[model samples]
Target: MEDQVELKRVFGDVYFRARRDQNTSIVYAHWYGSQAVETVKAGGYKFLEMIKEKPYRKLLNSNEHVIGSWDLALEWAQNEWAPQMRKAGLRYLAYVVPTTIYASMTMEMLIQRIDDEFEIRNKEADAEAWLLR
Candidate 1:
């Protein structure tokens, strides 16, 4: 949520910026624009890379500006990303669910596949609170 970005992933004009919240020691990412299967995979890689750099147990993933469903990436996200998050010592995830129906559904699918402590919130503030708590 701060301007202290550590890394960024760009797909066209969309920007996925990640930073470590010094206040809470949580790695968080916020992005804008639409998502496809490829973008989802790429974002997953970027998230993993960021989290793996530190022993961060919590993540705040925001999809508030994301415009499309990432349903096509569900298989890879479930089979690969989920397991890797656990391997990287990630224990808690606070996902800010998008407002769109399909995008929210996609988030639900991904959340259900995760085998760790996680929460989905409609607002970033709520997500951050849950992550910090």
Candidate 2:
């Protein structure tokens, strides 16, 4: 919690928080509820911006509270967001899968589409540990 930067925006449906520990930094994004494609896109852009400015090597995206499909945003995420984040020095990604079957499935779909090295788990602690290791 030493180098924590709260990246949450007032209007956005997603909550973001960026934290750094030694050489690695993590941008944590948790979906609030059902979100629109534009909302997802906006969150991605904000995430990229933060990592670029801070240069985080790890990203933790939690979809635990998501209630609807973000499948529409998957294409942009795989094609654009992932690549851009990698270019910005993102090497590890930890995704916290949603508890609901539908949301978890959708989140997994995006994970498979991404070319980056990442791990999917049900707990944020596990994700953090993986990112650190």
Candidate 3:
């Protein structure tokens, strides 16, 4: 019998369970839970491999911003995952969670980082219209 995978929601993100179809030699990430954050932080090389093992894609459907521990998340996403995905021809839309000035280095640094990595958009209307454009 073929194995079946399930999707779970955690902390507002949907994740998939990890599954392998031996006949097709394909691996799938079919589970998403709160543990995903930790899993990613703990060097989820297997997960990265799984994403590369097959044709996979992602669509960002939210406007949420990264809040607490934004730096850690940024470090992981940029230094670890983005390059691999780009090489694999995979695309992603991330709702970059916004952080307050106190939590981040500076407005210039944040903008430069986001511009260099991801497609960023403003979640709210305000004075910083230039940033979104």
The top-ranked prediction according to lDDT is 1
Better of 1 and 2 by TM-score: 1
Q: Tens digits of per-residue lDDT for model 3 on 26-107?
A: 3334222223355444434544565566544432212122233334455656666666655664443223233444333422
Look at candidate 1 and give me any clashing residue pairs. Answer: none
List the candidate 2 regions with Cα displacement exceeding 4 Å: 1-24, 116-125
Q: How high a TM-score does candidate 3 get?
A: 0.39
lDDT of predicted model 1 = 0.74
lDDT values for all models: 0.74, 0.70, 0.41
- In order of appearance, the predictions have TM-scores of 0.82, 0.78, 0.39
lDDT at 21, model 3:
46
What total of clashing residue pairs does each candidate reach?
0, 0, 11
RMSD of each: 3.4, 3.7, 9.3
Residue-by-residue lDDT tens digits, candidate 2, 1-133: 2355443446643354445555545666666677567777777777777777777777777777778777888888888888887888777778787777777788879878884544444465688688767
**Location of the lowest summed lDDT over 10 successive residues in candidate 3:** 59-68
Q: Give the distance in Å from residue 39's predicted Cα in candidate 1 to where it truly belongs.
A: 1.2
Off by over 4 Å in 1: 1-12, 115-125
Candidate rank order under lDDT? 1, 2, 3
Using TM-score as the measure, the top candidate is 1
